[model samples]
Target: MQNSKWVDVAIVGAGLAGITCGQTLRQSGYTVAILEKSRGLGGRVATRRLMATCADHGAKFVEPQGEQTQQLIQQLCDRQLLQPWTAPIWTVDAAGTLTPTEPTPRYVAPEGMTAIAKVLAEGLDIRRQQRVVEIKSIDAQTWEFTTDSGEALPLQARSLVLAIPAPQAVPLLEPLVAKGLPTAVLETVRKAMFDPCITAIATYPAEQAAAWHRVGALQPLQHPVLRWVSRESQKRSMPGHEVCVLHSTPAFATQYIDAPTLETAGRAMLQAGAAWFPGMEKPQQLQLHRWRYGFARSPDPMLEPLPHAKTPIPLVITGDWCRGSNLESAVEAGVRAASLLEQWLNSGHD
Candidate 1:
């Protein structure tokens, strides 16, 4: 995008939350621009290509439950970008005993989970890979930003929305905190917690997964290292090949959060997978992804001071953390932020 002097809104982080908020405010007829640090969209709903195969090492599926969320997923389905994924799953107990879980409706994209984000990104002024480093409030209504690149001057916007993780959002809003923001909001930001996860992607031989196709996914037993294991190829119904994504438990991720390398974390999770699937060939390819703020561990709204109204800077900060930690949660948080911003702007109140 060309350097615009100002915009109606300036959003930081182009993840699901940010994108959802963008869609909402756009419908409200507000000109918006988004700044994302990543090369592509979808913060946790990410995928990486492995040789000829691709693995969804981030968010696996979309379980849109509420009315609006259901409508959103239905749109993706009508577009043929997303298809229903009905894969039998098993839940393992603490003692390593496995029990088949009842069937549930799940959805997946043929290309990758990020397709949802791409769909939401249509007709939006999103500036990819622009890492916002600092935010300055010229006044209650005007805010300016500086990016990692020093080549350009500050970009201005009338309002701001933070669609990134809560932990990441808190530090960026520290300036507002020092500006005598509400104590309740400041406490929520300080106390909000996030749980990290290490995702491991491993590809086995073609025929190996089809043989055990009955088991679509695995919520492994009290395995210290592995928490979630699923075959992405099976989910995609791609015919042959077995590409699996393994997620480390919060405890395990925390333990290895400071591990030396990604390979180290990947190896640990891969070895654990070996135990569950015997005769499983050595991985043709293996990779690891670290999400420092993977899951929102914040208290429930009933427990914490998650007032839907009244925030600082006309800068509404939210993510999956305020609500539950899922694709659904992230989208809902974005809606809540947009709604609050709309009311705040309309009332001519701060």
Candidate 2:
């Protein structure tokens, strides 16, 4: 075995949480290395290209609820990366009746939601496409991490933070838990749940798909099949490129997660979306995306320290599911996790 490389902090999962953690630690004058499984960053803040059209497949827009988000939004606005979405949003009932709701200002990344992740990841030592398969306490002051690469070289860190979802993180922390770590932390992690969502992106020829309403997006919450129907093109003022992003309810998505085709997997969602919004027809191009851990279920373990009886390396478990009350909860959890880690690292324990 090769001598493991070491850093001050090692974080897995380069999503919003991981990136935010890396940013926090780096700004605090600590050396942190971020490892991500995917080729690109931004776990849920995703964007895709439907031929020539740009669609936000994961999070459509961010509605800032907390004070932290307000400040972040202002910074994003100053950088010209985010703008307020002033479009009309309506809720369609089961009877196919459109109920226009009051307009609320939401922040949207004009470049794409991934732009936000990119901004947070700037100047951080992020290792993409490297999934840390195993984490073990080598000594009291060191923790070793093994990646999924063919060689599986070991990397060690003085401190570790997990910013991924609970389901994904549970397996990683299982080694520590099985070694007689806190049972409460393990139970809390097991109880963490997230809703599934299947998004269908339908793109049409230029000017072929016309808007039924002047609004930017629509939500068919009462519909049995479709949960949301958004005109992604309208949000960014993409002229001539008509596109719609359809989202299925958690139950429906779970039911059809294994369906064969877009027609079958998203049949109900597509049919209901087209029925509610005019010109939402089967498009010239289409894409299907499945988010098994989409929206997080509320009330999870957050801001708690998982103290090891023997190991000196402290572990902080955090994710969007911590307090899934709102979209900003994940971001909030990320910020808090960093603060906790910094405090722990500066303490006598480490």
Per-residue CA lDDT of candidate 1, range 1-350, in tens? 15646877788999888899888898899888898998989899897876665778788887767765687789999999888888878888878787988777788888888888898888888888888877767756666777788544346777788777766766677667666456566566767788889998877777776466667789977778878988887666544567888899888999888878877777778777766775443787777888898888846652222333233357777777777777777788878778877876777655
| Poorest stretch of ten by lDDT in candidate 2 | 303-312
Q: What does candidate 2's lDDT look like per residue over 175-244, in tens digits?
A: 7865546776767777777888899988766575554655567787655567787877667867766778
Note the Cα lDDT for every prediction shown: 0.76, 0.76
- Against the true structure, candidate 1 reaches a TM-score of 0.91
User: Which candidate number maximizes lDDT?
Assistant: 1
Error of 1 at 110 (Å): 1.0
Off by over 4 Å in 2: 1-4, 178-180, 259-263, 300-312
Model 2 global lDDT (CA atoms, 0 to 1): 0.76
Tell me, by TM-score, which candidate is best: 2
